[model samples]
Structures are given as C-alpha cells and as structure tokens.
Target: MPRAPNEKAETAKQMYLEGQKMVDIAAALDIPEGTIRSWKNRYKWNATLQKDNRNVAKKCGAPVGNKNAAGGPPGNKKAEKFGFFSKYLPPETKEIFDAVQDADPIDLLWHQIQIQYAAIVRAQRIMYVEDQEDSTKVTSMESAGSEAYMVQMAWDKQASFLQAQSRAMKTLQGLFKQYDELLKSDLATEEQKARIDRLRAEIAKVEAENKERAGGEQPGDDGFLEALNGSAVEDWADED
Candidate 1:
C-alpha cells in the first residue's frame, strides 16, 4: 500500500529544507505555494531552519575564537580556507593554538582566559608603564631627596598596576565561568524556542510603541549601555 497522503507533505518539507526557495519548491513539486506555505506554517519551518543554521555554523568553525586553526577534513571548502589563512597567524600564537584542537566549552573558556589576560597587558601598554622603572641609586642623605622621590613614585606605580591586574583577573575569571556555564547548556526545545519568540515579540511591540510615542526616536547602543549600567548589570557582573 502507498505510505500515506501525508508523505507528500514530508517530501515537500525536505525539499524546502534543502535550500530550495518557496517558489522553486512549489514549482518543482507541482504544488501551490499557498499549500506549501501552509505545510511550512503547520510544521514550524523557521525553527527548523534556525537549528540547521546553528549546526552549519558549528561545522564551519564560525568565529568562536578558533577561526585561524590550520587544516581540517579534506574537500571541505571551509577547511581549505582555514588551511590557507591559518599559516599567516603568528607563530607564537599558533604553537599554543595547535597544542589543543578541541572545540569543547572548556577549551573555549581557556582561550577566553588568555584573551582577558592579554587585555590587562594592553591596558598596561596604553598607560606607557614599560618605561616606569627607576635606576636612581641614592646613598647619602644630601643626595637622597630627588632619588627617594623617584623610587617611591616607581614603587607606587608598580603597586597600583599589580593591584589593577589582580582585580581584573578576578573579575574576568567570574565572567568566563558564567559564559562557560552558558556554553555547556543543552539546546532549547521547540516549545522553549517558541515561548522565547513570543516573549521577544511582546518586548519588540512595547519598544515600538515607546518609540512612536517619543516622536519616532529610538535609543542607540550608547543608550542601551547607559540603561544596562543603570540597571546594575555591570555592577552585578563585577565590572568597575
């Protein structure tokens, strides 16, 4: 016996999923676009597409701190690009990067730690802290005045820098822990995704209403940052 009339709907779904546009799928399947659209609406194709995109992004190594890694499985164009671009990466960085080829959440957290540590280095460089060393040698009290001041200044600078670095590391470690927990989270089910979508729609509707009431003005990213700060997101996150 034939499988069922609903099998055609399944076939239509597969064609739509495999990169076929609605019109093209409808034409090829000899079905009206409206009928295909109805099948798509019934089956929630958008969520399916989002999941597929996430899988593709993972396979493509989509900019998750490992874009410059050398080599990959053969015949994949993304792998070929990764192979070509990775050689240009700095040798010192490559040595550390190549030592571990895993993309697990723990590996990602390790990379985040390195990046946060380098941020401290960059902050030091921006402040020209490298030239802060003192070589003044003072022995006699008469000659000690200027040299003592220089030595004390140098000591204070070093002490301040060390304190800043210590505080930054502690803050960054906590943030990375939160991110690692997020990364280790299991994928959301369709029901959860739908609920999230509905909540987002509600928020967007309120935003639109507010924008309209305020002479069509909307807040840019700066405003969002100010709001976040006012909301204490940064304070709660341990940011200074």
Candidate 2:
C-alpha cells in the first residue's frame, strides 16, 4: 500500500518555495537538515519554484501600452516541454529529470564511475573464498518424505566469483574510459582530470601487486586471489 504524504513534508516544501535555505527550514520546523534536503531533492522543490515563477509572471504580465509586452504568438510551444513532462512522468522521475537537467555530462559520467567502482570493491567481501576446502550448501528441495541438497564446491564458487567480478570490472573499466574521454574536453577542470589519473594509478598498482601474489597467473587461475587484500578499494571507500 502507498504511504500517506507527511504534512511536515508539505510544510517544508512551502518553506523552501518561499526562498528559505534548507538549514533554516529545518531549524524552523524542528526537522533535521538532512531530512529537509532529502525532501527537497525527492520532491523537486526547484521545479516547483520554476512553475510558480512562471505563474507569477503570467499574472503580472507587461504593463498596458508597452511594445515589450507583446509575448510569443498564440500557438507558441515554448512551455510545452515542461507541460508534457509533468503530464506524463511520475513525480519522482520528473524530479530526477529536473535535477539533472543542468548537470554537466562529465560530472554525470564521473558519478557513474564512482558507483561502479564501489560495487566492484564491495563484491570482494560478499564473494570471498577462504580456501579450496570452503564450500556453500543449500537445500534444493523439501517434500513430505524426501529432501534434496545442493552443494557448491569452493572451486566452483571461486570460478563463479571470478566470472562475475570480471564482468563487473569490465563495466567499471568502460565507465573509466568514458570518464577519461570526457575529461579531454575543455569543459573539464584540472581537478576532474587529476581524479581519473589518480584512480587509474591506484587500480594499476593494486592489480600489479595482486599479480605478483598470484605468481603472475592470468585472471580466473587457481592461484589468483582476486586482490582481496588490496587497500586500493579501502582508499576509494574512505574517499567516498
């Protein structure tokens, strides 16, 4: 069932539309600043402000006898884009679209890179294998007088982990490549360019160390540990 809207959220939205800062609104309403900010983003207060501004302008159109008061032709579709979106899109999705409309493409790509990298790093812990003897067992079926069990040997788990990690790494690498390409454009700042270089260097160092520990074996080999002990992922997590 859908939850009912909170009255406090509505009050916060009104306060925000009145040009109040999130922190100030939080103080006024006895709510946490983080909560206020979340509501602002979730409900897209900025988009609401834009609509209100347009309505205000329409209400107070140019004074009489002013040539500048001549607006766009009657059939103008200048405002149709927002209208169409509002009519068809769910509130949450429309809010996200409104929020990202002014975001830089480079910044957006970088955010994806961070997210992908984090996922890859987190998988190491979830899919960790202690040794060849380690295995996973689960009940496959249960019946009135019979039962079935499925057991995955350590090697099988390791192989599956390697396959999944390899796919995840490829996705991360693709994001890195896209970010690097975007960084080459003039719109990129020095800090943004430096971030990719630093990340690439850290990841390369980790891979090299892992290779050494594995006796230089290729990925998915029995000797490889998937760089489970590397601090590169830890550093990335700390940064985030």
After superposing candidate 2 on the true structure, give the runs of residues whose Cα lies further than 4 Å from its correct spot. 1-81, 204-240
TM-score of predicted model 2? 0.53
TM-scores, one per candidate = 0.27, 0.53
lDDT of 1 by residue, 102-187 (tens): 45554465456557646754755543333446334444444635533324455565556555655665656575446545554574
Q: Model 2 shows how many backbone clashes?
A: 0
Q: What is the lDDT of residue 151 in candidate 2?
A: 98
In candidate 1 the C-alpha lDDT for residue 167 amounts to 66
Clashing residue pairs in candidate 2 are: none
| lDDT (10s digit) by residue, model 2, range 6-88 | 99999889867866667656655557889998998999988999998998778756667877557668877534433455456
Q: Give the clashing residue pairs of candidate 1, or none.
A: none
**What are the RMSDs of all candidates, in order?**
24.3, 12.8
Off by over 4 Å in 1: 1-83, 110-149, 153-163, 166-170, 187-240
Model 1 error, position 149 (Å): 7.9
Residue 29 in candidate 2, Cα distance off native in Å: 22
